[model samples]
Target chain A: MRDEAALMRSARFRAEREQDWIKLEALVAKAERGGVQSLQFAEARDLASFYRQATTSLAIAREISLDKALLEYLEALAARAYLIVYAPQERLGGLIGRFFAASGPQAMRRSALFVAAGFLCMALGGLTGFLLYLESNDWYYVFMPSGLAAGRGPDASTEFLRSVIYDDSPAATGLGAFAAYLFSHNTRIAIFVFGLGVFACLPAILLTFYNGLIFGAFYALHVERGLGWDLGGWLSVHGVTELSAICIACGAGVQLGSAVLFPGQNTRKEALRLAGRDAVKLAIIAALMLFVAALLEGFARQLIQDAGARYLIGWGVGALWLAWFLLGGRSRR
Target chain B: MSLSRTRPTPNRQHRRNRRAARKKAASRVIPPEGVPLELPVASLGVRVAAQLTDLLITFAAAVSILILLSMLFFMYWSTVFALGALLFFFIRVPYYILSELVWNGQTLGKKLMKIKVVAHDGGSLTTHSLVLRNMMKEAEVFLPGTLLLTLDQTAPWAVWASLAWVAMAFAIPLSNPHRMRLGDMLAGTHVIRLPVPILLKDLAIEAPRAISANGQRFTFLPHQLDHYGGFELQTLEKLLRAQENRMSQSSAEQNRQAMTAIVERIRQKIGYADAVEPDDELVFLQAFYSAQRAHLEQRQLFGDRRANKFYADARPRGTG
Candidate 1:
């Protein structure tokens, strides 16, 4: 007799609640098939209410020790509902606004120390390369790739170097291809530097310093031929943006490496994850900077010839970047 | 209703038990509501297959884009080539990051495979994590992959270095229980197999009948029902559910034989003497299942819960 009562209680429980379960299942299935947006306002509300009810039922089922199958079904339903309902709902427009106005600059500012370290490494590498090139002209061949040198080497005449830097002939037609190539190539290198930072940050530092050596050696070659001022004007127009972007990428990589190496109180994995948040934001902003640099390198540098105007524009952009990082995303008090 | 009752060999039963234990060891994620939910981690094989599907898609997209560009801008082939190269180089990066972002952690391949990435902390999937994880893929997969393609031209030490990197990348996932690659480990994300919701009808409604084709009802006394427990009831329920689904004639024959063996074993254990007709085997099992379930639930109410037939206190009551 007691057995019969227990059986009837369970049956009645299911009979009373099964309809809601079926309804919730249908709503969840629809959402899964055609995203959460497909649901009407009423249906979405219904989904939330049903999800709560299902969770309650799951709790009750555990208390009463209902059959295993019913408990499993309820658990699955509640989990699916939780994931769908709690998913991040910010639209793309809002996300973009938040990224630029807050996350991007704020993340770059937060990692200022690492960025400084990155800058220091590059500067020391530049000094070393400059001194080495001055000591022996053959260091130019070692530091700059022949292809990238493009006939501007220690042996190239000062007039030829000036012509190369101030050349305005290939401005409109071939600049597009040049810009595309530089954007893709430099972005690839930046991403590579960032990714390889996981191996204790040495590789990231080495790559950044190697790039600096190339820059310093090339500049020294022009300084040797008395075309240093012209080359500086030509390169700075884009180098200010491009080199800073690469430094940012290197800093992000170092952040990852340091997180792994010195994972304070948290586990190494957790530290790496926390660091990745800011590092990735820095990486994205760096990529954007690279895009701007690519445009300036391909078009603006070719069109502009005055050394004074070039320095003004390059340093002006640099100052703007500095201001943006320092003050872009501070919350209003 | 006695028949030959051959039990499964102990070794086979042990192996089956181990497999079930492994299946039951799904990871639990606790939601904000304080309820812990079980989510099964995807198998390495399925993850690999999904990755292959994604790679094939990206490769096909890049090749088609190249061909289309070459055809349209034949006169400006140089510019087209550079633009095409940029598109080809960057397509996979955005394809992964944006698809995961827009689809809520599912790429087209992951959706097809019915798997998705979820945060290890049970929070919403963040855009930062998605970007970070996919960025690491450049190091984990593409870098070594490109190196291997140019192995014939590279030095011996470079070949070894690339090979070591490839092996390390492959081994990271295998080393972890969740099968997380380097990116997943760093991003605090893991992939999970989605559950398929199956709604089985209430079994309590299948009360014993008064009459059947055999001209009598199969009834179980209280002592007979006490021979099993809730775990056995669940196993019986699964078998019955499987029987309900349509199957080929050969499998149907095998199912019938399996049911006969089960019926024979129950009779022996409960000492039931009534003869159940061969055609009425399923009816007898169903009647026995509901009765056993009711007995277990009543015991559970009195705080004398029996986990399975193997529970020491749940030994047959004087062999019925």
Candidate 2:
């Protein structure tokens, strides 16, 4: 028969080479199932060499081979090898823990200058707003929109103002609903301050300034009404963490902006990606702080009306946060 | 001599002149470092489906809580009210967060839809991005809709402001190449289509038994089978597949020519002495395919790949 010698030649090729292919196949199977570490060093080396040879054979087989089955097998095998060789996605929790414990603080420390800059802008704005509001009560209207101010301007009755600052009662709409709204509002502001840093940090700086302006205008209103002490107690209960979180967020944003504005060696995109990672870590920490701040505001501020007690709680919470950032998760050994 | 040695040199006299000349020419565009050329942005239909699924899920949870809270309120009004406050504020955001976290960037809805959220760097998802993007949904989507629905005589400015925000939310995606939502842009994330592989009918039908008319098959010795590599094998497989479904006469003719040309090229390259009948072309390729595949796979185990066979063999190694 015409196909008899061709069959003999095919049979002979298999007889000679089939053993090694079988060996390599077994090794790959064992490695995939138990991990490549299961192999001894020499065995692992063999796998690598076998992979290269398999890659070559795949090419040669393509040129003239008639076995569709063999080609498919090699194709799948090579893909598995490729995955083991190249893709290195790590466990998500490990990465998250790694970020929080070390990289987050490291990044925060590196952006100290930006933090100072944000604080300065906020402080200046607060001072300006305070000075103007003192000159004329109408300046509160100029600084804060009517909607945001919630008629807390000069026209608001003292009783209404007192209720807002020391409203020991559960929020009319349910404390949770109010807290949720406030948290969402705070989160949105932080994200914008961070995200808009791509525009050369101008928007972030201005937003930080505006935040301080509102704070200053609010403080001035309370001070004018002879309720400045009450407002301080109320704000202090959450302000230590809440305001710091905002400042930290703005700092992170400015850092991201600077990556674009002063990318020295990397392309702007690469610089942004690198800075974005750092900024995101800071934002995560800030978001966590805001959660804690909301907790204090919801429970402590609602229960405590004494100025001394509120101040004590506020300072205590602030100290805990400061210590955590500086010292938590540090290695002893 | 090699072709380059025979070619005439260019006439630029100085390095500066050559540089200037090159500068005068049209610039070639290269992709900036981080951007990848090809990624399939999820279509709007699938995105909407995923979103609706998530909305339904969130709504169900909220309703379940509402029912429970109502029961609790009947039992103890004051205590339940306080508990309700805490739950209402806390539940919604964490639902999104915990799902994304545990699922590794897939919510239950996203899993059902076979899509995933990925950080733009195509790395693991971060808590900050998930939080930021979801919080933005409150500002950009929910809050506006709530205000519009709740207030009968909302300030004209408030209505316009809400409308402008909603417009921005919808408009940003349409304006961009990535079709990214506003939240995605802010968080540097994307909803990507994750295509799970589907099965196909097996192409590996058994090789037929056919006698060569010449009483001989073109015998390819082992060494001669080393001309091509895996890349070529893939090409050959593709060609065979392309011929697999040639039901139409027109396509069948094209396939026949392609098969004939490929067989002839292999015959010439390997110096197979026997003449292969055109009618037996398929059988010839099939026989060669089996032998060559076997030979290549064996070579792979030995660390002797074609194209790089010489380079591999040249590496210094200790005899073990």
Candidate 3:
């Protein structure tokens, strides 16, 4: 008789709760197949309530030593329900808006010290490269690759140097292609620099300095031809944005390296995780900046030949970026 | 359900214990209500398979786009090349991030593999986490992969550097219990295998009909039922369910032989003298299973909980 009673008790227990489990399972299945958007308002509310009830049933089942199969089913149901209920709800539009309005600029501001360090490294390298080139023109070949130098080396005549900067035919014919190529290439380099930052920031620093060396060498070649002022205007049209984007990318990488090297209060892993949040934001913003730079390089530099106007547009954009980074998301915070 | 307790040989018992031990380790996350839930981490092999599937899909898509663009802009080869580069990045990068975002951490490949990314802290899987993890994939997998493919063009020192980087990246996942790659560790996320829910009918209901169908009903006394516990009963329940599943003629013959062996062993353990007919083997087992389960449930209420048949010997000397 006792055996029969025990059997009946378990059977009754399952009978009482089976309906809820089946309902919850159906809801979970629908959500999995079609996402939370498929659910009606009432049905979504039902899902949450059913999830809580299932969790309670799981707890009860464990305490009372219900049949093993029933207990396992309840556990699985509860876990699935928990994941669905707690999933992030922000839409893509909202996420992108939030990033621009607050997260992106805020992250950049937070990592200013690292960005400064990155800039210092690049500037110092530029000085060293300029001085070496001044000492002797042999350093020019060491710094600039043949393909990149494009026949406008120290030996190039003044007229040739001027013609290269003032050239606008390529922009008319394939400006779109040029911009796309520059965007993709610069973005790849920026991302690569950010990624390699995991190895103690040394690689990022060296790469940034190397880039500065090439720029310095190129500038010295133009200066030798008495085209320094003209070249500055041509480059300033896009270089300000492009170089700053690279600097930001390097800073982001340095953030990761320092997080690993000196984790401070947190464990190394924890520090790296925290730093990744800000570093990713910085990296993304840097990529966007590179896109702008690419556009400027491909079109504005080609169309606008006036040196003074190019400087105005270039530094004007730079100043605007600085102000935006400083104040864009402060109100939201 | 057979009350005739089958004693597995020592070798089989050891193997079973080891199998149980090899079950995937679960990560515990505490929900808002404070109940800790165990989510099973996906195995390394499954994760690799899912990644390969995703990579193949992206590569195929990128190639198709490239071909279409080249065909449309045959006159402008440079434009086609530039567009192709942009298209590949768009397809590859957003394919991962957007798919995971929309599907709540599952891409097509992850969905096919029945795995998903979940937050380590049991919170919602935020957009930042998803993007961060996928971005790191470029560094961890794609960059090293491209380096390896272009090894002939690279300097010898570069080859060694990339090789070391790849090894370190691979070793990180292997060293961790959760098999978390660099992205997962940084993003505070890990992939988990979704459980396949089993909806078998209650085993208790199979007892009465099976017992009544046989001319000689197999019955067990209380003491005979006391030898085993809930764990053994559940294992028997699984075996019975497996037997009910349709199989080929050869497998059916093998199944019958295995059941006969179990019946013989069970009878020996319980010291039952009566011979159970061959056709009634399943019926006898079902009857024994229900009786043993009921007996275990009653003892459990009295705080004399037995985990398995081995519990009797494992108990303290005084308790036995």
Candidate 4:
């Protein structure tokens, strides 16, 4: 039989030199994992020697060896699980999340203010376009591509304008066409606003205000020309959803821009990361609204040429939108 | 014939020795696997998910806040009111509460996600930790952005430098084991996995008694030895008798002989055979030695084949 004392001496001797072996073992394990550079055969043998010495001491003392491969494999599995859980839903969530994160209370207040401002500007823009229509004594020419004016001036209201909005083609594609155009346009606008955040929202603010004023001008012109009811019914059909989307885009843009400008307690980079998240969410919601608006404007509104029917549709969409924005969303969580 | 016989004998003994060593390395005293170790810092993926979730919740929360703030701002900016009423509760309150609560605390996202917050020492988070973590947000998110926003077409060098600085600060967690952010380090708070439910009552037994390798009676706690001033042969005779009474079989008798030889060797080495009997300290030491020696002898005879070479080489020349 082997001497028990000699065995104990060997175990103790191995324990004394366990540290070098552990390092070598770790190096070899890492090299085998392919995350490290190459090693010589001598290095590999040295690592093996260290592993043997450590294993011997542990067997004598603590009675265990760590399983390096199992630990790494488990870590990798955990990382992959995280990616699955957090990544998929993030696409839309990220868009809207940024707007909320950037503004907090500010986003809500700015949105409300912008909504009111949008109404005013749209009415104003409509009014200017109406004035231009009346000046040329060509109210029906406003919607015509041929009669459209140069520069930023409003186009004359042409016969084509009213006819096209209300007309049904053989393909019956007015609703789908308008919906596609409106949805794509709104999404583009929202993204543009969000991207322009690099400029601290100078471009976004100008864009929002320009659209708002144009809308206001359009509304004012009709009201002044004794075409208030006709215009109101026409605008309300698609206007509620379309305009709501524009407002949302502006909200997202403001959020992105504000993070850059006021980053306040947050670092500018961190704030941008946050703002970017919220803006994306808002942009998606805007796209959904635009889709609904275009369907109403091109199909439902155009078919219901009766002033009263148009008025009712407009009021219904407007009320629904109002409820969505204002009193409808009450802490569902 | 001697070489063939000796070769198999040594190979069997060597295999037994190596097997014993490997088993000792894998056992941990306390089982930590099932217990939830608090997560100090989440990886990058978790951080991004949390940020995204907070944004949506904040947007809803922000609407009300923004409305009030805008009213106040409009009143002041438009000069419509004699005095501007800045309702701190509307804007600042939610901002402070939500950032600390959701971003650092329990943002709706985190609440839905099943994670929690704690100090680095594994204590409940304090108010100071919350404020400090949120306050550093400006440095984390905005200052560097201002340079990019303002100097877009000009001072490319300055913009790049500022961006690099910001990235470095954000990447600080990557370099540390704990993955602490600037605020987390300063406040000594950590985001961790919530404690999972566990039932200890389900265990049938805790810490069962140890059994001797030779099937002899064994006691974990030390006690006074009954026999005193006994010679090595006398103790072995007593142990053999006691063991015979406890176990019945030819194998038991053979194991007893092996154990006796191992114990006598240990007793001779420690120079404790001359000591008087019934020494509690000696008995305890003897018990440990007995267990170790028995295990080693069994391993030498029946363990890994490669390990027996040491003993084979140590034998007298031409012993085979």
Model 1 lDDT tens row, A1-333: 244424455667777899999999999988887889999999999999998888888877775655677878888888888778766565767778998899888898899998887787788778888889999999888877665678988788888888888775764434445546464435655766787777789888998888888888888888888888887888789889988888898999899999989999999888888888888788877888887788777767767789989988787888888898999989999
Error of 4 at B147 (Å): 29
Clashes in model 3: which pairs? B1-B288, B1-B289, B2-B288, B2-B289, B3-B288
Residue-level lDDT of model 2, residues A79-129, one tens digit each, is 344323322235557766877777677767767788778778788888888
Please tell me the TM-score of chain B in candidate 1 relative to the true structure's chain B.
0.82
TM-score winner = 3
lDDT of each: 0.79, 0.66, 0.81, 0.46
Label model 2 with its docking quality class: incorrect
Taking all chains together, each candidate's TM-score versus the true structure is 0.85, 0.62, 0.87, 0.36
**Top lDDT model:** 3
Which ten residues in a row are the worst by lDDT in model 3 chain B? B205-214
Error of 1 at B34 (Å): 2.0
Q: Which CAPRI level is candidate 4?
A: incorrect
Off by over 4 Å in 3: A1-10, A63-68, A145-147, A152-159, A171-176, A183-185, B1-24, B48-75, B143-171, B209-219, B229-231, B298-305, B312-320
**On a 0 to 100 scale, what is the lDDT of residue A115 in model 4?**
41
Q: What TM-score does chain B of candidate 3 reach?
A: 0.82
Give the poorly placed runs of model 4, Cα more than 4 Å off. Answer: A1-162, A165-171, A174-179, A183-187, A194-199, A216-228, A273-281, A329-333, B1-320
In terms of lDDT, which candidate is stronger, 1 or 3? 3
What is the lDDT, from 0 to 100, of the residue A122 in candidate 4? 42
Model 2 over residues B1-320: C-alpha lDDT tens digits? 48675544455346656654543331111112221212345655787788778877776676678677676555345444444444543566677767775555667787788766666654445666676567656545766665565334636765775677677777777665456675676576776565322222222234454346666654568868877665566567566556566368887888788888988899898888777788889878866765565576567656665543253465469953
Comparing 2 and 3 on TM-score, the stronger one: 3
- Pairs of colliding residues, candidate 1: none
Give residue A19's lDDT in candidate 2 (0 to 100). 55
Cα deviation at A201, candidate 1, in Å, is 2.0
